[model samples]
Target chain A: MELLCLEMDTVIRARPDPNLLYDERVLQSLLTIEERFLPQCSYFKCVQKDIQPFMRRMVATWMLEVCEEQKCEEEVFPLAMNYLDRFLAVVPTRKCNLQLLGAVCMFLASKLKETRPLTAEKLCIYTDNSIKPQELLEWELVVLGKLKWNLAAVTPNDFIEHIMRKLPLPKEKLALIRKHVQTFIALCATDFNFAMYPPSMIATGSFGAAICGLQLDNGDQSLWGDNLTDLLAKITNTEVDCLKACQEQIERVLVSSLREGRRQQQQQQQEQAGPRSKALDELDQSSTPTDVRDIDL
Target chain B: MCRTMSINLSKRILTALSNGPTRRNLFGPVDREQLQLEYQDSLRKDLEDASRRWGFDFLTETPLEGGDFQWEGISGTKVPALYRSCMVGAVEVLRPRGASGLGSAAAQSGKENIPRTPNRDSLKPQSLEKTPEKTQSNNQSNKLKRKQTNITDFYQAKRRVVATPRKSGQ
Candidate 1:
């Protein structure tokens, strides 16, 4: 008898449990405890003397690219960023050690969330071998200490299901909507501006942005503009004005990020094509499909 | 030849530009010595804070004076080996909660190791730190678990007495 075993490489995922998703208490507890995981303050304004917001963006971008390239669990990237933000909020880290911190955060988050957690050696390689595996391991303790070992952070990804289940999304489009929302959550994580916002707010705003961007709202009056904002604000219990502002800010970040990703793509294409071969294919590039990139929320 | 040269040049340019996975260093070269000093310094600070909060000097393995909780000492043998604070004397590092029991697991002979193989180097330093992931130790590896005497394990109804019980019942 012949046996088939071609699918061994696929990640085995548990179906979303009805027990957790269907329970209102689960959502309430998430909302209640989510604030505990938020960074105590915006570190740039107070705690960190050396690290700037742009530097954060840079490290965050690098970290995102690594996670994407590695095909890490979707929550892994945002959770890692949560660790990074929480660590930076309390510790006065120097500029040189920022990447190390980023690596440590990924190490901790991946371990917390993945079945096959990223090994310390591989993470070190992603840092261009700037750090040794031993150093990564060593600083893991330091990062843990700084975080007070609160590794199970309530990330925006945690809120996606509870919020989406309540929204009037079409059943068929759920998969695509989820993908876009997850992408937005990862994007929000990379931007330091969204670091302090509660995970639920980010999740709700991402949902609003996803529905609006896809023009899903045109079908139903409940999902249109102010109505949509009111619905979303009610789902997450966010202030209406605050939710409106958050959703709009999320849209702006998406636009700028797309522009940045486009510019970077063009530059890379031009440089790769070299000066002699072709005219700057500016028009050709924009017509290309939107590739959700390192910063493309 | 010219095309090949352009491709090589572009490849080099991209590598220099830090695109894809060529993996450029973010903040430039780190001072290894300085990093070590800072790591030690931060761990020290963490230890100090933990000591104050828990009212236990993790380094000295003793309770501090005028603290929130009273201190008591127990011989390592009485408790389950997993909770023993000073099972192995050579390693003393600062973890806010001295789950030294875990670090001691690394030092213990193979007869009693946790089912998971912790990296010795990793466990060496965090001798005091709690390994938050050890929750599965209780459910797995019955052979490694050092089975204890539960009442049901040994106390069961007697099957029969050979003498006259069956005949008498009849």
Candidate 2:
């Protein structure tokens, strides 16, 4: 007799252990070490001469697109950005090598975070093969060496669950809250200004912005305005004044990125002569980032 | 099912990537020779820095003069069988590749054996930044297990490099 074999091949993710997410020590320890992992300096001023801030944004946007298209775990993009920031903090990389560095960062982060890590071949293809697989592998060691072999640096994403578990968010909107928080976090990663901020602050700021965007803070006084900032600051041990500034920065970034995304989308539509309907534009506005001209920060 | 979904996903990626703006190279053509030269220079500088900081020559697997670390090497026999990648006994060839397991980042690297040189690059990129005191006294056996070999050797170990208090992480 022949037997039919059957086993689902879905990615096996561990359930969030309460021991990790709920334990006070886990959260506190994360806050303590989060600063240690931030890039050592505002690299554009001192360490880098050939590369500009805009170049970093260009690579970051591409990296985010790759992560999104490949369905990489949420932490992978942020974690890779951490490595990129840290490496740039030290190494004066040439502009020509920046994309190679980005690919190497993604390659390392995927290996660290994914069940099936992305192959070097695949990453090269994503760069339109501007970089070879051999180059990616060779640079991986150089990047690793500069990182001091510390691949486990704490990222803002680490604080998400720790912060969320403490928030008074409605149970039904937990998933939506997480989605927005992650999007905000990714946006911050792409921006160079947030590069030097503590991961906990970014996580805290993203949480504040995310909560506001989804309007999940309705009917709760403790979750509104200054009160919400105080609550978030308390959770992450960030100063209230600083947390307010970071959240405002995040909001500004969201508006600008939304505009940038739309500008590109509109250009593409014009080239094809397929004018997008206003109804569709409004629908799109509800979802993507905007970098419009008139949004006041 | 996941495989089929990935196949569909990859197919979509292939078509979009042909002329997709997302797929273009950001920085024009790279000077491959200069990049390779820089890679070599950077690796040499890193090894020298490691040597000075640890007081051990990682390239030679030996101690250096006037270094922070006091280097001592026990014979392979002196080290426990568990720490050795291949035991001297019958288990040499048959050891499962996953023996190092996950989170053991690059543990057992041969990369540490590359020949070293004095620093060559005039552009000292990150020398200005201060390295904090190496506070964490990581266990000896733990350090030996997940060490890096050359880039070509292994991707076997998982979380080999834990985020310890050692800021510069050499």
Considering every candidate listed, which one attains the maximal TM-score?
1
- Taking the tens digit of each residue's C-alpha lDDT, what string does model 2 give over A1-297? 999855433567899898898899998898888888888999999999999999998899888888887788989999999999999999898999999999999999988888767778778888888999899999999999989888998988999999998888888677767776777788889889999899999999988887776555677788887888999999988999999899989888766655554556656666676655656666766765343123321
Structural similarity to truth (TM-score) of each candidate: 0.76, 0.72
**How do the residues A94-195 of candidate 1 rate in per-residue lDDT, one tens digit apiece?**
899999999999888988887667777778888889999889888999999988898999999999999998988788778777877887787788788899
lDDT per model vs. reference = 0.76, 0.75
User: Which residue ranges in model 2 land beyond 4 Å of their true spot?
Assistant: A1-7, A272-297, B1-19, B57-63, B66-74, B80-170
Model 2's alpha-carbon lDDT is: 0.75
Q: Give the residue spans of candidate 1 off by over 4 A.
A: A1-10, A269-297, B1-18, B85-170
Error of 2 at B54 (Å): 3.7
Q: How well does candidate 2 score on lDDT at residue A293?
A: 22
Number of the top DockQ candidate = 1
